[model samples]
Target: MKIGKQDATYQLERFSKTQAEFDEHYEKDLQPIAEKLEEERQKTMSLAKEQAKKLIIPALVALAMIIFFDGFRIYVIAALAAYGAYLFKDVYEQRKKMRVKIKEQLLTALIQFLNPNFTYKPKSYVHRNQFIKSNIFKDDPNRYSGDDLIKGFVGNDDVDANGIKGTKTELSFSEIKAEKVEKYKDKNGKTQERVTTIFQGMIFVVDFNKDFEGLTTVVPKQKGLKISLPRFLSGEKGRRLEEVELEDMEFMDKFTVRTTDQIKARYILTPGFMRRLYEFATKKREVQPQNTQKPETLKEAVKVGLNVGGDQRRASQDARNVAYFSFRDGKMYFLLSTGKEHFESGLLTPINKSLVQEYYEDINKSLELVDELNLNLRIWSKE
Candidate 1:
């Protein structure tokens, strides 16, 4: 017995509707593109390491061959600087180009997966606040390549004067925006004043399973925005690098931090950092005579403050009045504390009302100005 023509038509229409629903609901089909981009990222990163290794190791080896072994002493330092700068330019630029290319390609690939014929045309560059007619480069003379260009723009005597009608900074420097502040607390509930106000930079090393997605680790759209330092910082010992502290919140007004409860609880040490420390220790330890000299460089200032030179090494986690946050489920937990001098001791997050009131008490009217058009701030420890 053959089915009726009308029945067959009805069945086909029902199947078409079901297919559309499935496409809208499930996105498993797009996984391959995401995974491919991640693979490309890994490959690109590996290539970068190879370049750095080739350049740095050979440069150091060449210097060693000329120095202690060949008595080239003082000149080795200069040679090393020149050689290091060249390799850095080549390798660093290449790695940077590759990353930008891959991320752009990844975005295109994602769009393609969503709509196969979506024909993505990537932008040449991502601008910071292009919606406004102002050029950020105009106000920040330092952002330009040369002092001459800046000097030419603002002639000798003109540079010293801030005349009202004189061509103002190329940018509308007056257009201020909202500022976000991260408040840290002691157990007794007092906020610690940062040693440095310009916490304009920080580096984060987030660890997860190799199978995990890289995008999950990135803080969203953070470039160019003013940043505040996080409450804590971490570091590696053997890299000749010192303290890896969180952003000095003193720098930015807004920030968003995330952590799962599991990651918060473990607070794992970076494996690569531990490996470097062990390797440096095991290698023929060079015992050098101690030289007492005052620091001249900015980094040296920090090293002296933290006692980071010679054999006197301290852990990044050793900084006092530090707080560590762990986000599990959805709640935040602050584990670190001020050493009996400040807080009562214990965790503090999503701070209580009493704590908030106490913090505002320290706020000075002159140091802070937050309105619709302006955001001004100048915070420091009270003497």
Candidate 2:
């Protein structure tokens, strides 16, 4: 389904009506704390800026004087003066730490206000093992690092049309990033290394209600003859499980499927389910802009390459690269590498109703994936 501003507005209205007391509590209690933290952050930044001016102005003046004099002695003196000014680096670091602490405090308070059952950690992230298990990205521990983890439950003891009662679905999501080092010799014969991002995005894991065995990985189709040839030649050794051709030719063309068992794969990837995945992938692709414009200058080309290199690689793997699904160890993992930081607001900006509602809506979008894909449909397993 297309998630637009209407969904956000409706969710906000419903939340305002059902959770009026929570809003009142936030205004009364959390607002003061956030204001205090913002005030402290402003003061800290102002002090740092003042100190930077005091240090930098003198250094700039000394450098200018050295240039005007055009003497070796003056150059040496200016260099020493510049080095001395660097002594205040510790103070700058301290200011940065203070600002980060304040932001963490504000974020924590806001999250607590939003859902008492949920927890947020500014410095913590989903473990690398979990990422590898998810099979969303290439399993490379050396390249993975993440933070900004949030975990909680969504449903309660709510009854449904099928006479099934809702359970507390355990959900955890975090920002994850991976990088690869490109070591090459420059034209001057000097070795240079460029750290390029392999994958940068959020990963959300939901505990599936059904018990199942085997691993199923659904990945975007690999294009180009050169890339597809290696997998075709290597057979199953290339880690490409027997490709299950689906009934939907369009879906089959878009995604390459692999499964440990063909029978189970057919059971899991039903026509209805494949249609939902296809729609979600198509929606994400439609929203992404196709930049056909090329860089006008050499410098612009280099800059553009540096900025979009990782994106290019990710797109080659999956055009959208926004959402990926894998089932392993009886848990449904949604690897969403949209390259956007969700649930984060500007530190200086005051938290308003709209901002909070936006955060709620973004999270709801992730949670809704479980229902959207009908992941809890447990016909095969006796849950």
**Measured by TM-score, how close is model 2 to the native structure?**
0.65
lDDT of 1 by residue, 36-136 (tens): 54454456445545545665566667656776667675567677667656644544454455444433543333333322322323222112222111111
lDDT of 1 at 364: 11
Q: Give the top-scoring candidate (TM-score).
A: 2
Candidate 1 steric clashes: 14
Candidate 1: residue 274 Cα off by (Å): 46
Collision count for each candidate, in order: 14, 0
User: Candidate 1: where is the Cα deviation over 4 Å?
Assistant: 1-30, 52-74, 84-90, 102-383
Q: Assess each prediction's global lDDT (C-alpha) against the native.
A: 0.27, 0.58
> Which is the leading candidate under lDDT?
2
For model 2, the stretches where C-alpha displacement exceeds 4 angstroms are: 1-33, 65-104, 113-115, 156-165, 181-194, 222-240, 282-321, 340-362, 376-382
